[model samples]
Structure formats: structure tokens, C-alpha cells
Target: MGSSNTSFRQGFILVGFSDFPHWSSFFSVLISVFYSLTLFGNSAIIILSQLDARLQTPMYFFLCYLSFLDLCYTTNIVPQLLINLQGHDRTISYGGCVAQLFLFLALGSTESVLLVVMAFDRYVAVCRPLHYTTIMHPLLCLSLAIASWVGGFNNPLFQTSLMMVMPLCGYQLNHFFCEMPILLKFTCEDTGGTEAKMFVARVVILVFPVTLILGSYTNVAQAMLKTKSMAGCKKALGTCGSHFVVVSNFYGAAIYTYLQPQGSYSESKGKFVSLFYTIITPMLNPLIYTLRNKDVKRAVWKVLGRGTDSG
Candidate 1:
């Protein structure tokens, strides 16, 4: 059957942080700061990677994509969230809600898969150092990057379309924004089967990529152990550590958000987790890489100094 021809004309009120009236101003300011940092940091990574020829390598290639994804990912949600945080009106149009849901799901899924691809990049760089350049050549890197995006955007398209068509009891969403599980509450029918299907899909989207990330890291660890140079081991750890931090922050929140059986989740707790996942994680990513990565720092300097190559 086709999607419903009738428009969901009514806009949904985002009852965001309403339960904690006291923290409204606090979160508004905090989220605004986080959003700014996220934009600046991710953009810096992308621009620096592009401008500096020195950063034109497989690892930084993935990092550039990651930064771009984070930039788009946060932009999809934060503006609306900031509006809701400050304004008297806390409503989102039906069209806007669906767009957010689709884009967020797609971007988040893409980031999950991209992280796995990055892990593979690290694996090849560390475990198979001699063959790294030959293996992760331009064509293969472009292919992997394209695959991550295509897979990311395509998987959520059908599901989000079907979800948007469901008949709703009302337009007042229980929580902020348009997450699937939370929006399931407003559904007029029994969502048990649908919920089950969604859970299964979520598992496939999250688990598969996460499993690959873990596997790649495991091999990386073993390979590092076999190597005698402390410098090689140190470099390997430095490369993977930032990604590991990002993965734990992102996946921990996402798993709890999606996988935990419906209704068991505390809305307030979920709000906090969602904030961390959506805002804090993106903000921390560049900071983590900058502090832990000498190459990135030197590249930043090289770009600023106009060709003082560190190497």
C-alpha cells in the first residue's frame, strides 16, 4: 500500500524538559554551548583535513567523513531543540518531525557504520602497516565512504516512511523530538508487533557495526602485542582510543535508548541520556582527538602556519 495521501496537518507539541521546569534555563544555555562547540570542532576537523595535503591519508580521510557526519547529525536536531528550550511555543510541524526522525536515524546509523569502517582503517594501518597504503587506496577509501553513506540513508528510508503514516491518537509527543519508541506511545493501535520488528531492526543496525568495530580492535590489539616497538604500540593505541571513547558514549546511550524494553525507560533519564548522546558526544569527539592525537595537532599547526610541515 502507498503512504497516506492525507497530510498530518496538525503540529506536535514537544513537551521538552517541561517536567523539570527548574532546569529549563540551565539546559537551554548548556545545550546552546554544546551545539556551538560541536559545530566549531567538527567543522575545523573537516576544513583542516581538506586544506592540508599532509592530512590526505586513509585515517584522516575517515576522520574527515566522521567530522562531516557529526556536523550534519547535530544540525538536524539542535536548532529545534534550542528553540523548544527557550520559546513559549514548543511545537514541531508534522513535516518537520518526520524529517528529523528520518535524517537523525540515517545519520546516526551512518555514524555507527562509519566508526566500524574507521576501525577497519586503523586495523589496516596498525596490523597491516606495510600494506596500508596499497590496501586503502583512493578508490577503496571512496567506495567505503560511499557505502557508509548509502547504507546509512537507505536503511531508514522505508521504515521512517511507514512510521510516519501511522494513525495517531494525538499530536502531543510525550518527550522531546520524534524518536520511534517514544512516538510509539501516540499510536492509536497495539504496537507490540511493530515494536518487536523495530527492536529487531535496531539490533541489526547497531549490533552488526558494533560487532565489526570490536573485531577490528581485537585484531589490532593482538597485532600490537606481537610488535616489538613501543612507538608502534603507542601510535596504534592513540589511533583507536578516540574512536573507542566515541563508540562507548554513543552506543551506550543508543543501546539503552532503543533496546531496553518500552515503558521501562524513565523519561527524565532518557532525556539526560539523549542529551549526552546527541550533544555531548559530538562535542567531545574533536577534543578527544586533539588532545590525544599529535598528528592532528601538528596538522592544525601546519595548516595555520601555511606549510610548516611537522614531518
Candidate 2:
């Protein structure tokens, strides 16, 4: 009888596999190259920021922290994705899957929190220019940074703990990674109450940070408008542009995934957008900030000792 039960559990449906994106060889190469570039570019930014004493301002400090987050954020998903693409059908063990869910949740949440903190940094820098240093001093920045990580960790810990307690019997996960919503869809047990509980968790973990970001940006716009000089306003707008672009992409994708009704989970389209946040955004972040800002360029060159004219 025990053997029969074991065999039945073993025969459970495996809805997921290690096989990666279904693409031609050419497309595979293109994706591989893109992932490599993302890793290299983000690492360089972190290194450059750390070595350059000139980049010790609040802005660059947050940027360095962001680079670190991007590195972690992409690392959570991309490497596994690449392995799967190589025809490995990467079968993450049950424990491994749980760990991935935990880390991914933590890092992703932390990043959202960090983005809000950055918005606050910009608000202080622009709206309270006279007291910017006082408001965004080093100690305060460190504290905020630490708080984001703690908040990130606590969110996943609570959610995952709740999930683990519920019995998972026959269902297999469908997506490449262990996204909370996708995982929730597969449980054979009653998940209605679990789903509601998770929804409340989402509201607390995600909605509050989003509200903070919106409030900060609102203040920033008001501050920018009140500036006496047109040049000052223009410069402030330019400085905020990259942050705005990143904020839009990150929050837009996240809102669709987490904030939507349960029935709205479109497997195909949602997976594609999830890729944007999990893979593409991290790569584009450094590029967006560096290309648009002259200060970062000067600092990068100073640290690396390279120039446009010559090697």
C-alpha cells in the first residue's frame, strides 16, 4: 500500500520542464549575448562607482546600490534561464524551487522599496535643495537602504511560510520560475482562503511602496515647477528623466502581475512582461542612467582612465 501511494505521488503531473524559450539558434545566441552584456555592464557600474571618490554624493550612492540590486535581480532568473535554453530542461528540486521563490521575492520587493527611496532622494535634492544634504545625509541613506532590505526579506518570509504550511499534492508549477501567483494557481488543495491572505500580503508589501513613490514624485513635480529659473527647471527635469523611465517600466510591469484580478493572469503575455522586469530592465538601467547623465560619464572615465579620442 505504501509503495502504491509512493508511485502515485511520483506519477504526479510535471507541467514544467527545464527546456527554455522556444527560439531558433540565432535567437538563442542573441539572448545569450544580451545576458552576458547585462552582467558585465552592471558589474562595471558597481565597480566604477565604488572606486571613484568623486561619486560619493547621495545620487551616485543610490546608483551604486541600484547596480547591486540589478545584479541580484537578474541573477535570480537569467542564469537559470540560460541553462534551460541550452536544452537542459533544468529541473530545480522542490527545495531549490522554494529557495528561488524566497530569494526572488526578497530581491524583487527590496528593489521596489529602493526605487521609492530613490524617489525620495530626488525629492529632497530638488524640492529641498537648501536642506538636501541635511535631509539625505549618509547615515539616513544607510538606514533607508537597510530598511528596504529588511522589508524585502520580511515580506517573502511571511508569504513563503504561509505557502509551505499548505499541503501541495499533485500539481506541478507551469512557469519557468516560481512566481507566487503562478505557484498559487497549481495547488490542489483549497486555495481560496490562501489566495485572499496572499492578496492582503500583496497590498501591504507592494501597494504601500507604490504609494510612497507616487507621493514622492508628486512633491518633486511641484518643487520643479516652483523653481524660479527656467534653466533650473529644465535641468531638474532632465535629471529626473531616467529615474522616471525606470520607475514607469518597473512599476508598470509589477502592477500588471501582482495588482490585477486573479482571472486576469494571461500566461503568455504575463510571461513576456515578466521577462521585461526580471531580465531586460536590469540591463537597461545602467545604460539609461549613464547615457543620459554627463556627470556619471565623467566619473566613469576618471575611474577607468579611458577616453573617446584614444585608448
Q: Which candidate is the best by TM-score?
A: 1
Model 1 lDDT tens row, 1-311: 12222226676888888877888899889989999999999999888888878778888888889889888888888888888878677888888888899998999989988888888988888888899889999999999999999988877886686687677667676667787777776777676877777777788788888898899888988998998999988888887888888888888889989889887977767777887878889999889877867667777777778536646
Taking every candidate in turn, the Cα RMSD to the unseen true structure, in Å, is 2.9, 3.6
For candidate 2, what is the lDDT?
0.76
lDDT of each: 0.82, 0.76
Give the per-residue lDDT of model 2 (tens digit) for 1-311.
22323212442222333333356355457667777878888888777777766667888888888888888878877676666556555466666667888998888888888888888888887888899888888999999999989988898898888877665544445565767777666565677887888788888877888798789888888888778899998888887888989888888888889888777787666667877888788889989888867766776777666743232
lDDT assessment of candidate 1: 0.82
In candidate 1, stretches whose alpha carbon ends up further than 4 angstroms from where it belongs are: 1-7
Q: How many clashing residue pairs appear in each of the predictions shown?
A: 0, 3
List TM-score per model, in order. 0.93, 0.89
How much does candidate 1 score in TM-score? 0.93
